[model samples]
Target: MIILSVESSCDETSVAITKDGKEVLSNIVLSQIDIHKVFGGVVPEVASRQHVEHMTQVFSEAILKANITIEEIDFVAVTQGPGLIGALLVGINAAVAFAYSHDKPIMGVNHLFGHIYASQIENEMKFPAVALLVSGGHTELLYIKDHYQIEQLGSTLDDAVGEAYDKVARSLGLPYPGGPVVDKLAHTGKDTYKLPRPYLNKEEFNFSFSGLKSAVINLVHNAEQRNEKIDVANMCASFQESVTDVLVDKTKRCAAKYNVKQIIVAGGVAANKGLREKLAEQIKDIEIIIPSIKYCTDQAAMIGIAAYYQNKIEPAKKDYFIKGDSTLDINQS
Candidate 1:
């Protein structure tokens, strides 16, 4: 089956074509990183504008480069919600229009499910796996009994790991999308500040990064008041150490509780070099399934894979799609 998918859930606009779920014919992503850099974070309006400008070409190039014609597409897939409203609407509307013109089946896919199903591009998926979803907007642990089943084990009570990274990096005057920069600097400096690992010993898998973020802010504020020069590298290192510690501990606990044979680390933070290394070293004996860096974040190929499974069900035909609540359930993920 030829499935064409579009993703504009956030700043990046991506389009992809997948055959039979596993083979990726073409995956094109136009990143708006440079556009949002000076602003320190994504501006919803700017993201929406870029999506509108690029969505058309992104879809066209993806299909053309895949050596396929629109007539050959069997399904049209798109991310429906739990993202910036404007950004989500861009993809939903585009998919609807395309499906209508082509008379193809249209499927609305959950953003989180796209992340989990990204693994299909690499290898066959086995059920009963744990999903560690870490991203700019969300941090969640999920139990997957099968392709259509997902139970959120626990999630953040406050800020997500990536959000914390951005806030902490801003404290150190670093760039936006701070997780990666912090991870890189972490290697050069020692964990000198001993940053707090919020909810580290909590009985449940739920996390709380807001406290950690506040801690970093307080430390930086006090240092500025005292006219003390801060070691940015050490600060980054200290912060990442705390973040990774929490993720590792919670992941291990979930694995033990569920007794799963595999763990799939999904979402943008799944591309974190530090997090990947930590999981690889700690998750012994069980297979660790992570999409390649390209598929780790937002992309349509993953969306198509999830839609393929949902295609078994009749899709709801609609010209307009609703933007989902931020707290939308991951069971659909």
Candidate 2:
């Protein structure tokens, strides 16, 4: 099946053409990092406007690169929610228009589900798997027993890991979209700052990054007050180590508790080299799957893969209406 998917849940305007959900014929993503970098974070109105400006061009490029005409597309898939409503609407409306014109089936996919399925693009997902989804807007742990059967194992009570990373980077005078920047700096220094690992001993699977974030802020402020030269790289390395330690430990405990056959890390933060290395070193008994860097971030190919499964499990009706839902929950969807 040829699936054309659109994803504009956030700052990226993306489109992809996939064959049988596994093979991506063409995946095109136009990032707004250059635009948002000036503001130090995403501006919803700006993101929405940019999507409107770039959606058409991005879609066309994906189709052209796929070397397939609109007539060859079997279905249209799009991210419908759990993102900025305005940004989400851009993709949904475009997809709705295409499906309406082509008279083809259209599936509304949950954005988080897209993140989880991203690993499937390169590795076949095993049943009874545990997924650790870490992103700018969300931090969640999920248990998957089948294609449609998913349970929320845990989630962050305050700021998501990516949010914490950005905030910490800003405090250290790092650039916007701080996760990758921090990860790169982390490798150059040692973890000498001794940052606290929040909720490390908690029995529940929930996460709490707020305390850790505050700790970093206080450490930075204290050093500045004392006029002491701080080691920015070492601080970054220390912060990353604390976060990675908690994430890996919790995920390992969950995998053992649930007796899952495999573990998959998904979402944008899953691209962190620190987290990937930690998982590789810690989770030795079970299968571990992490999507390639390209698929780890927001993209349409993952949405297409998710829609393929959604279509098989619950086909959309002819009159089904697509809408943007910023708070759409994956477990309920």
Candidate 3:
């Protein structure tokens, strides 16, 4: 089946044409990274406006690149929530309009489910797997018993890991979208700053990054107050080490507790080299699945893959209606 998917849950306005969910015939992502970089982060109004401007172009590009006509599309899928309402609305409305015009089936997909299915683009996911989803807005651990069946194992109590990474990077005078920058710098230095690993002693699967982020902030503040030269590389390494340690540890514990067949890391933060390396090294007994870097960030191909499954389990009605829901829960998807 051919599916055309739209994703505008965040700063990216993406459209993808996929065949059978796994093969991405065409994926067009118009990123607002450079635009938001000037402001140090995403501005919701600006993102919404940009989405409006680019959605149709991306949609046309995806269809053209996929070498398919609009009539060939079997379904239309879109991210419906768990993101900025304004940004989400742009994609949702676009998908709804397209579906209505074409008289095609429309499926509303959860943004988080899109991230989880991203790994399926490259690797076939095994049942009874544990998923660690880390992103700019969310950090969650999920247990997947089968396709489209997910249980929330744990989540961040405060700031998400990606958010913490950005805040820490800002404190260290790093650029916006700090996760990649910090990961790059970390390879050049040793973890010598001695940062604390938050929630390490907690027996539950929950995560807490606020304490770790605060530690980095305090260290940077103290160095400035004392007029001490801060080592950016080493500081980045130290912070990355602490964050990865907690994430890996909790993920490992969950995998063992559930005795899952495989472990999958999804979301934007799953692209972190540090986290990937740590998971590969520490969790040796089970298969580790991480999507290609291109699929790690927000993309419509993942949404298309998720829609394929949603269609199988919960078919949409002819009069189906959807709206942007900022707080949409994954368990309820």
Q: Each candidate's lDDT (Cα)? A: 0.86, 0.92, 0.92
What tens-digit string does per-residue lDDT give for candidate 2 at 1-333? Answer: 999999999999999999987999999999999999999999999999999999999999999999999999988988988899999888989999878888988888899999999999999999999999999989999999999799998999899999999999999999999999999999998999999988744788999999999999999999999998889999999999999999999999999999999999999999999999999998899999999999999999999999888888877645648644526576855
> What is the TM-score of each predicted model, taking all chains together?
0.95, 0.97, 0.98
Model 3 alpha-carbon miss at residue 120, Å: 0.5
Question: Candidate 2: where are CA atoms >4 Å away?
Answer: 323-326
Q: Which ten residues in a row have the lowest lDDT in candidate 3?
A: 317-326
Clashing pairs in 3: none
Say what the RMSD of model 2 is: 1.3
